[model samples]
Target chain A: MDHDSYSDAYLKGVLEDVRTIAVVGASDNPLRASHFVMKYLGDKGYTIIPINPGQAGKEILGHRVYAALSDLPEPPDMVDVFRNSDAAAGVVDEAIAAGARVVWLQLGVRNDDAARRAEAAGLRVVMNRCPKIEYQRLFGEIGRIGVNSNIITAKKRPVKPTKKLI
Target chain B: MSEKKSFGFETRAIHAGAAPDPTTGARQTPIYQTTSFVFDDVDEAASLFNLQKVGFIYSRLTNPTVAVLEERIANLEGGIGATATASGHAAQLMALFPLLSPGDEFIASTKLYGGSLNQFANTFPRAFGWKAVFADTDTPANVKAALTEKTKAIFVESLANPGGIVTDLEAIATIARDAGIPLIVDNTLASPYLIRPIEWGATLVVHSTTKFLSGNGTSVGGAVVDSGTFDWSKDGKYPALSGPEPGYHGLKFHETFGNLAYTIHGHAVGLRDLGPSQSPFNAFLTLNGIETLHLRMERHSTNALTVARFLESHPAVEWVSYAGLESSKYHALAQKYLPRGAGGIFTFGIKGGYDAGVKLVESVELFSHLANIGDSRSLIIHPSSTTHRQLDAEGQTAAGAGPEVIRLSIGLESADDIIADLAQALEKAVG
Candidate 1:
């Protein structure tokens, strides 16, 4: 579905009201792609509950990081899966048991079985798209390039052909 | 969110402005490119004149197209109200006019756009006898120390221009609240997609729609967003809100408009008198840009992170400062405020130094060396020679555009292509 199909009333009720999101496979390292994504979504008014067994119970982005979805204070609105495909099915099962309303896999992290299982559990499925990117795209916030340009950005230069001297 | 419960962003973007246009039953907002509106009768004109009714009387005050754009922006920005202006600078000025007067001051970050630095250092003092005390905005302590009784507000960019540095907004917002002043953030770089300054305690938000919102290098425009949380009524300093307006006889804005007082006043006073309203055409263009902002920002961030890492390892590169890169001082902060992505723009210096920097920019085929950022096509500029061309040596260094610095507004192009172009340019520069 196109982003424009999502009205503000829908966004406000379902999107903005997403109080907590458990981002599975979250990394502690600042350079890790997952780390920034969690931090960004958290900062964007969502309560990001970081999930990583390696760094479970440790604080990430000032929120109490957990090892699993079940460890969260309450069921999150979304469980954003960022793990490899091999383990996604198990993660989906965990999400179902944890009673999450939605399951989102990050770009390039896909699992059909896990997606199916989550869908069976009556959860919203968003695969292969980053929620942050989705938020901007949906809200009409994209910065377009080239199309709206009429003014030449190039300087009025004194063009001279390169000449070889004997 | 599903279609039943949740619609996509593209859907929300188009239909967020109330319903279908009543005038022509237009499903989409039509660009009403006109200067004035006519009244049905003398009494109707009198109602608009008295500020007792809501209707478009002048394009400068309100236009059908501009109103749709304003409402869309306000919704997207998570603001209660927004005012569109002719340029980003105009938006800043219009937001400030309501609060500040002669001798009144504002505290600002030194790490700002060259244009903003020039605006605060030069234009503000001369324009209104108003002055800005520049302080380092990165630290919470430094921001707090800069506050004073004379200060009317605290202004900063969501992300510093060119520098690609993220501001500590929550702390600054807290400072503004404690001091009974508004925290105004220029969210031009870290557009609402990356971070919403309003939710993070910013009382007012300003944007230069010329950059990211318009995306393409189209028309110049600016916007002011009110969070509807700042208690303007509590402050006695703002006579514009509390006192009677000469235009409207004894109608107190704070008493009447309440949360929307600034928005109404901005529409009625700032745009009405300053006549810096944004064109409907520009607003339409910006709205189109907004629809793809999220997708573009994602690609831009990924491309930037890839490019930043590539430069960090390149032999011909001196230093790169992209928040996505772990080495950047702003990386930790970037993670805090903008985890989804650290924006599309990054800055670096060439190993061959200033002359090589100049050659690299001139040699690039794919990269359009320009002043603007957040473009879909990759852009390169040796700031010392272009955007920061006017700055002296010291000022140049302070703005993160040292003699060797080459700023890159990473676009949505293939990462390999962008890298190859840079590599070839570097090779040609050194040779």
Candidate 2:
């Protein structure tokens, strides 16, 4: 599924097995790009959530609003979407019926038959990518805003995983 | 950060664009010294004045300490973001303000920096009719026979200032990618620690973060970077980045900031209509002088190749331009684009000519007759009596500043006390 080139080890194995995302067309109008990628993925500690069917239950940076990814209270290891590309084909079928295990899509959202029906229901898709610019281009955090997060190396960056995962 | 690594370059130069003070954890980067930014209402100040979000609403178009020295010199020049200005001639007029337009035409490199050939042959053609031409780009076929059709961009200097010329960046980046135009370079004397003009393909890099990425001699500032791989909407010929911005409402900056459209239109319309920002206390002293830019460019390229092999075995010297020497004719394009060295500035000549180059920069006593160049101590000048004393004599020998040159900038000091203070200032200027 070449949704326009990926493989930084399949986007660091779907952003290192996500860790709660949701976002959908989330916004509280902080001049929406899904409210600045949901306040930059809730200021990087993730667990974001938002969703917004018109701010379903209100609240954005403090996470709450949920109108679907089947009104989540639990199931959300990633769904991102930020709708468009025909509402990311029904938010990739409600993120494979609200049990998402990755589906991403955001930066100018794409669909490809809703990413082949969310990889034939086992989820994990990604498409027009932008999990906050791929978790700041895979953890180096967009080189603190000078961009070119085209990953080089010599190690030393890690320390981020705050918590989440069964 | 293994998952197959990435971060190096001295840990992205002491942690790229920094972190820590997300409000008081303040591990350094703080000079935000106010001038606006409070918003949180009026729809976050009309989404930061309709650029539809990307915070900061002032300090001349963004500041958090000059956005961490414009994202630490766009992450030490790999690029894709950067702006920081107010010098290096406002980063070469904000890297030609989103690609010229008043009767466009660009193409520089006549071995630049005599105040960038007097701001491109007299202040960008008398304050913006934007012309520039000049070529001799050390033969990239005289920059594709100085291209025309109102050229639009090519500029160089990946290690040029004061001659030791080296622009041939992948043959003028393959003639600005087969003339689609946009090369830019100026990497202030090879400063992505000795050249990173967007790793040789260059599509804008500019600097002069007051020479050598603020490696001391207190910041004057400047940066441009970008290299978001220019496409600018495939030859629509940069209508200020593929047309539409009649002051943001028509928007369309490369169709909404894809690859951050020319560094977000160089801070929303060239530092918001040319204000030339950069002063969160000189971007916090050029971000602590770029956290020791790789140990001061390896002791300023080993004290400028030991003061260019002591003025090429001086006996009052007569020539020594210094592309890390071996009789430099840009010594194999400085070992294929500055293979880490050839950098603490160069230039020589002497054996008494223009009054022994104004008596060896008024007889140096530990250099510093300066008109400035990546300083840390040693410095000197004399270009036909001080910075190409207003060009002419065929623009000071086609900008190499001839008339018995002299230049030098070598500065992490002690290379045998900078070759015994230029050997007693060449025995009192030509013994």
Interface RMSD of 1: 19.8
The list of candidate 1 runs beyond 4 A from truth reads: A1-166, B1-11
lDDT of 2 by residue, A121-165 (tens): 887787776766666666654543345565544344453532321
Report model 1's TM-score to 2 decimal places. Answer: 0.71
lDDT of 1: 0.76
All models, DockQ values? Answer: 0.01, 0.08
TM-score of chain A for the candidates in order shown: 0.74, 0.32
Model 2 lDDT per residue over B109-147, tens place: 887888888888888888888989888888789889889
Quote the positional error of residue B226 for candidate 1 in Å.
Answer: 0.8
lDDT for each residue of candidate 1 in B293-324, tens digit (9 for 90 to 100)? 77777888899999899889988887888888
Say which candidate scores most in DockQ. 2
